[model samples]
Target: MGTLKAWMDYLNSINGKEHDSFFKPYKEGKWSKAAIISHMMFWDRFFYEERLPHMLKGETLVGITAEQVEEMNKKAEEYAHSGITLQEIIDEALKYRQMLLDKLQDEDLSRTFTIKDRKISLQEYVNGEIEHDEHHLKQLKAK
Candidate 1:
């Protein structure tokens, strides 16, 4: 198992009780712990499943519109409240992450992709994913 695999396993260990604490709001009507997980899973799928393969094949990156981003966020929020189990979200995320890791070779790490009108390497993107996960995990722990 690689570092990514380890992280995925750690995420998979989270239970509903952990999710309840993780998703608890600082205030009412904000994103719950489940919503946060859904948001993360949404992006994991977007990047690994949708964007990464295109990027690896030298296809033009699809730019996200503000409306699309909003819609994704809204859908994520709904999914969070849909009574989906925390383990389900974790499993999906891990599967996607593993898919990404499998596709990424050492040389591919230096490959670049355009995001938000800026060019960033695959290594940068993977690092960003790890950082994003860590940040959310912190938020979950803080609740």
Candidate 2:
């Protein structure tokens, strides 16, 4: 979770720096940095509110369909362009992230759950999210 913590710290450090690049797309047809952050914020909220509760109760996790994922991403990108400030997006994301971190503090990382017929442990799920974060960070940092 060190990478997670570091990612949180990086977000905090850039909360309201007023960088123009943050609002521009990295490439034509690609999501802007703010949209990428918004996408992450939405997922963090989903994991914290929709998944973690059931997961902690040892329930088989419900999986989201590809269409649903596409819809969610569309909505997130829309929200990012809906006049909301970048700082607000970061704050919301951090809040959910902190909740997630707090909730996992005493959790058994090896606890397994089935999502879409695939079995995964909490640790593996979190590691995947961490990788996702790293991938986006690189995208954001690229010129």
State the lDDT at 99 in candidate 2. Answer: 86
lDDT score for candidate 2 against the true structure:
0.85
Show the colliding residue pairs in model 2. none
Query: Model 2: per-residue lDDT, tens digit, 5-49?
Result: 766887888887887777788899899999998998899899988
lDDT of 1 by residue, 89-128 (tens): 7777677777767777544677887866788787787787
Q: Candidate 1: which stretches are off by over 4 Å?
A: 1-9, 15-29, 105-107
Q: Pick the candidate with the highest lDDT.
A: 2
For each candidate in the order shown, give its overall lDDT on alpha carbons.
0.71, 0.85
How accurate locally is residue 70 in candidate 2, as Cα lDDT from 0 to 100?
A: 100
Error of 2 at 128 (Å): 1.0
Weakest ten-residue segment in model 2 by summed lDDT: 1-10
Clashes of 2: 0
